[model samples]
Target: MPFFTVIIPLYNKEKYISNAIKSILNQTFTDFEVLIVNDCSTDNSIKIATEFESEKIRIIHHEKNKGLAATRNTGIKNAKANYVAFLDADDLWKPHFLEKIFNLIQNFSEARIFGTNYEEIWDETVKMPHNNSDSLPKDFVGYLNFFKINIKQGIYNHGSVCIHKEVFEKAGYYNENIQLSQDLDFNIRANYHFKLAYDASVQMSYFMQTDNQLTRSSIVNKTIPNYDAYEEWAKSNPDLKKYIDFERYVLGKRLKKNNDSRWKDMIAPIEAKNLNWKQNVLLKLPSSALNLVDKIKLLLLKVGVKPSTY
Candidate 1:
């Protein structure tokens, strides 16, 4: 069996699919199979993926257009290798991405989850901010501490993560109900059941496409169920409720940016004593005032200034 089953979820990423597949083919570690889960793309994404002549590549088409969560779950169920790695069709991986992850597994043999650092590719001109650790840490022990570490510094990108297949049997597959932050949901479940390790070197490329991206459309359409999903998960795990409340504050900012009034109801201003000064103040503002705040923030962004957060 192959050492890792690389699962690439494809939608309408025709422009970037070739490079994504090529990156996998060029990996320094070669004991792997590429499982391309095409979620009924209407574009040439499928054509580009199938053009790869490598025997390691295989394509599976969804009869209907399933969302990201279902597409990922499909790939996990069909993965043949002992470990599964996720790489979005628009993302790229360094030649040693898999090799480094394999080394981490060998170093921390007791760990079930492993991932590497990643860099975001915005455009040809601007450089994306770097927020990764200088070096990889030893295994992270518990879910609560690990979640806090993620809030302070990102734990890992989905593209850079490699999970042992057994974890899925215990933690269950990705929730198919959520439209956005599905990867975070899966990681929360997996981390709760398994120990985690990471390789700090940047090894994955996260493309920040200006258009044709899910985040772009999801923002306007109100489909991201980030708050609800996390709140549901937090119900059974009381210790993690604080983290879910934290998500509420972050989501409030996002909804305010979109001029979305849904943010008002989603946040409980009375029970939000845990929030910082700025967050609490924002939550107290009326919906109309929130839009004005969004406009001011946008003006600040254009002038290269951002509101300070606590």
Candidate 2:
């Protein structure tokens, strides 16, 4: 029987670690190992995982409070199977998630990295899949097609993705420096050499527990810009330039953070695509005139306008 090596990096997840561990232990695919790296958590997460002690469960202890990326790296270093998967301490895997991916692994035979759909739950509500997380190709090679669109299909839920051990040998480990977007950065780097398998069956029930009314707002403040995690990865992988128009985009973002020369440096590579409608007189009509134009465009689109096509 084939097996997967699942790595769960636990911090202060005393509140949710038990459920996350139990969900993995209950997987329909039985041949696997679960390695829990207790990242110097200040809470009872270690006790919670220890409660699920079995021959299949192993724990790696990080004596200091290293951030998520380092803790996850510990798990990767200790992984003992031919394949690896990750689940965060605050999430629960749908029982069949692994079985689905493992089946696809056998069928595709050539797949190196693969991911499944998951539900993002917050305050008992499930957020719809990303506005751009759509266009889920039903077969292997989905990611190759996705790369053409550039930074769009970031479907690899850290909790629901699995990769052959060879993936790391090829793409390397997650950048420990990036505070956020580490997984996103890792996936983009991985796709440089690996083919991704898409199967909607890999579902995990996720919960966002933060002290905020809207989770999106909390993420932007707490994680999004803590460090330019994705930026470092993109800089290293120049191939991503087509998909992430990062340099030109800095112009539209918080203008106060951007300086003129930095903005020009970004626009230099793709100056051909820099068509500024904001500076054009015809494009900047009165508000009422613009509203009327928008309405007419909608009416024409009611007839037809090409979709970017998911």
Candidate 3:
């Protein structure tokens, strides 16, 4: 059997599917199978993915469109390898992705979850700068208990991770109920039971600002559900309880960009001491003023200023 089962949830990513599959096929570490789970795409995605002729490639087509969460679960169920890695159809990985993951597994044999740092592609021409100095110690290898890693550096993206199949047995699979932030929810749940092993080197790419992508959709529609997901996770996890107030504080700022009043109640539980002077000032602004700031931030991004620390 292959050492790793790489799962790609395909939808309408025909333009990028070939590159995504090519990235994996070119991996320095070749002992892996590429599983493409097509979610009933109405586009050329299936045809494009099928054209890639490789003995290591397997395609699973869904009879009906079952969103990302269910599609991922299906991939997990069909995974034959001990380790499972996820790749979004639009993202690309450096050639060393599997090599580094294999190295991490060998070094941290006891850890079940492993991830690599990633860069973000903002648009056609812009790319996020890679800075590894801010990551955990370079020489250190092992588990950073989920709570600490999450509190310090946010959870690793699924596209940049590889998890032992048994990890899902202990923590459970992605929640199919939520439409947004399912990735965050799954990571939080997994972290609750196991520490995530991380490789500081950058290896994966996140393509943002694409049309119809879940993240860049209507802010109000997406942001509200993400906050609700955070709440649901916080209810069962006391370790995450301490971060809820702070999470709410951040979520509130995001919601204000859409002139959303929902953040007002969300921020109530946060202590005044938790926020800094700037945060306090921003929180006091009217919705109109906050949205103006949001517009300015978007304008800056459009003008080629990198506002995000990828």
Highest TM-score against the true fold, candidate: 3
Rank candidates by TM-score, best first: 3, 1, 2
Error of 3 at 278 (Å): 4.0
Regions more than 4 Å wrong, model 3: 130-141, 151-155, 210-215, 219-239, 259-262, 271-283, 302-304, 308-310
Q: Which ten residues in a row have the lowest lDDT in candidate 2?
A: 251-260
Ranking by lDDT: 3, 1, 2
Model 2 shows how many backbone clashes? 1
The C-alpha RMSD in Å for every predicted model, in order, reads 4.2, 7.8, 3.6
Give the candidate number with the greatest lDDT: 3
lDDT of 2 by residue, 136-234 (tens): 443433334335433433455788788888988888888786665676567666776787777764377766532232112312222322223345655
Q: How close is candidate 1 to the true structure, as a TM-score?
A: 0.81
Please estimate how well model 1 matches the true structure, expressed as its whole-model Cα lDDT: 0.73
lDDT of 1 by residue, 188-299 (tens): 7787678787766778887653233223543555455554545566667653566556666766666665667766765653246556577778766765776566566445
For candidate 1, the per-residue lDDT at 214 reads 20
Question: Each model's TM-score, in the order given?
Answer: 0.81, 0.71, 0.84
**lDDT values of the candidates?**
0.73, 0.64, 0.76
